[model samples]
Target: MKRIWNNSWLQKGLRNSTFMQSKSPHQIDPELSDKLFSIVNDILPPDKQVKPRTGLLTFGDAPFHISQPNQHDTKAEFEHEYQIVTEAMAGLRKLVPLFLTREDADQQRTLDLLRLEFDAKMQQGAPETPIDVAIDLVRSVVADVGGLRASVRIFIDLFRALSERRDELEQQRDKFWNLPHRAPEYYARAIANRLAKLYARKTGQKPTSGASTDTGDASTKFTKALEQIFSLLDIQSGARPPADWAIKNLTEEDLAPRMSVLENLGLGPSPSRKGLSMSRCVLPEGPKD
Candidate 1:
């Protein structure tokens, strides 16, 4: 029988097979995968991590399954499908935060699994990102319940409480950009959304606090937002001095920078400057365009 080489919307994703082949699960040291899974598994809710037959977040239409009678099955196809299945689980890692936030017994185990998958996907180059998607979905799911504010606040929680981790997330975005069609907008939109949450977390009426005033380890979403807002504004004003966040409030325009690229990625501090710095590589849309 002749093989049919048909393409689907997922074909673009399939093109990302190079990402999957690089880190086949069997290649992962069994001891390490076990140890890591054990640690994260210990902290998560029992039965939550189990890949259920169905759920709110399922691979409903994700073309990870392809059964063909005409074609000979090869390792490449098998590996690609495996990559799709594994890559799609990217969001479950963020369940680590859910479990950790609740201090579940299996928090350690869940976190370990998350770390292992996050690292493996990154190293393998597949960029199977469930964390990013999960957060976005959470926002979507919450929006109906809390309206835009809930969505906005969750974003704030992500940006400010975790702004220090922005560097790592940006690196993942850079990796994803190298994939098919090169979704630079994916990075920008994600960053902007997070920034918006960071902004709303700050200056907005709502409040969430971590750490103690007595300990002087206070971390309010406000501080992170201000820093990011100033950086974004600086990007817009052609590298103006970072605004004195000491002042009262900031507007969206105040946060808008020229193209607003820096905060979109690399808001994490760098040695090149006291504040954010770009990764220093020309994207596809360089000056030649």
Candidate 2:
């Protein structure tokens, strides 16, 4: 049992396969790991949990989808993300035998000292915890038990080589990313692109030129609207657009172009040709108080 259980492949995978300096904490200990494996083995169902689909459960779940149409829909999607996180954490809990920590140091110590007083209990074998009991076992894996740092370096290097191929493009991508964008026109174009993406995400289709956001109350309605707008405007946020965001450079024309640019890029929900022509389009609510 010990020979097969302490297989070399397991050691190589969990530590060297990833090329990290260390294995997951569970990788270090044998006895404690066995305990966790036993527990998780008991808890996991016969099959793995199936991923759900997009829109609804009919196609299986795609956890990243917005699914719904409003802010509340987005919030619901995030709540599902939380559920995924909690579920994964629960699985990790089952896979660990010693979940104790520095704060738990005293409790584990008490268990250790008590074992001394009642050595028979150690011989008899103790029960388990929901969190498992591996981490509190000991520090520093020895050469005999595959705890040597040299082995770790070998794995780390190999892992780095493998991952090096995977994310190599991700690294060099940033160099050419905005290289095409060096001038104010780049920012202008970017704002246009972002506006289209926003329109697509909200409506899931190309926006019409007639779909402009019409407000009845600027102070009340725009108070909430400005929070989203300033964030898009790349201005500092403090409950609302900063004084300088309003006074210094943020003019109606500056904001106006963004709307027209957005309509050109594709965020037009309004039918009017001047989709973002703010001066031509926006009329203040109720004569501004």
Candidate 3:
């Protein structure tokens, strides 16, 4: 009897053979593997670290699986992991401005398109938290790439590259001020004027050039005001507000009275709450096309 080769099996075997030939040595030194793992752990925070599966033989070229902490392991362990995740998300939120001001026009456009998709997802009642949105974005990208591990590896590599070139990235970000996308100087002046007004209102006197005010206290107040403004505008903290909603229109006095009324009614000035109304505050009609 003549033996015939299966076409699909032959193709698959060729592909696998080619892949193996192109890959590095099948086995890695145990010490070297451990050192590599240690380096990765040192580079990434706990939440972003990749863990190797124990009791399994892995080749040098094997893909690494990025796993989330098992929530069912223990309540204390879960809470600890939760805290790390929260801190990671907060750190990510702080990086939003840098992410938005990409030096490459293509990257900036890609991010803008992603934001549009995020907004559409939110409108469809997806979880509105930044963490949830981030997860959704990751899932979408993973799906597009056809492999979670590959997508995660790309992200990890990009993160490591960014960490190594933080200073260069910051310099590039500074150059974004010259771009016509947004006005950073105008916003800086607005924030400074607002802070000065708030300082004067609280102290019943204008701040002098050499006045010795508590720097920490002023910083805390400034942070709170910025948070409140972002919350009221239904935008992220580092994001630019809609052009129609002039920053000049939303004065401290305008919000102060409304905030007091909300406080009296056991509500805060949150865009999410039905109690808060744009009409109550001195805001423009709405964002234009």
Q: Which candidate is the best by TM-score?
A: 2
**RMSD (Cα, Å) of model 2:** 26.5
Q: Residue 130's C-alpha lDDT in candidate 3?
A: 51
The 0-to-1 C-alpha lDDT of every candidate, in the order given, reads: 0.34, 0.32, 0.38
- Per-prediction CA RMSD (Å): 23.5, 26.5, 22.7
Badly placed stretches (over 4 Å) of model 1 are 1-33, 39-140, 166-289
TM-score of each: 0.17, 0.18, 0.18
User: For model 1, where is the 10-residue window of minimal lDDT?
Assistant: 61-70
Residue 16 error, candidate 1, Å: 14
Error of 3 at 94 (Å): 4.8
Model 1 gets an lDDT of 0.34
Q: Give the TM-score of candidate 2.
A: 0.18
Best model number under lDDT? 3
Report the lDDT tens digits of candidate 1 across residue range 1-289.
Answer: 2233345655466556433334433233444334433432332346423122344343221101111111214446544543543333333223222322213447656655755554443333322335344333443345335333333334434433343233333444354433454443333333333433333333343223343457533244433432333343232321111112222233554344322222332233322444211223111121132
lDDT score, candidate 2: 0.32
Model 3 scores worst on lDDT over the 10 consecutive residues at 62-71
Q: Please provide, for model 2 over 1-289, each residue's C-alpha lDDT reduced to its tens digit, 9 standing for 90 to 100.
A: 1112346676465444432233432122334333323332232234422232223113221112211111223435545644554444344323222321113557667745643544433222222233122321211122223332223333333433333222332322342333463233222233333333333333334322211246422233223333333343353433222221222332333333224322322323343543323233221111122
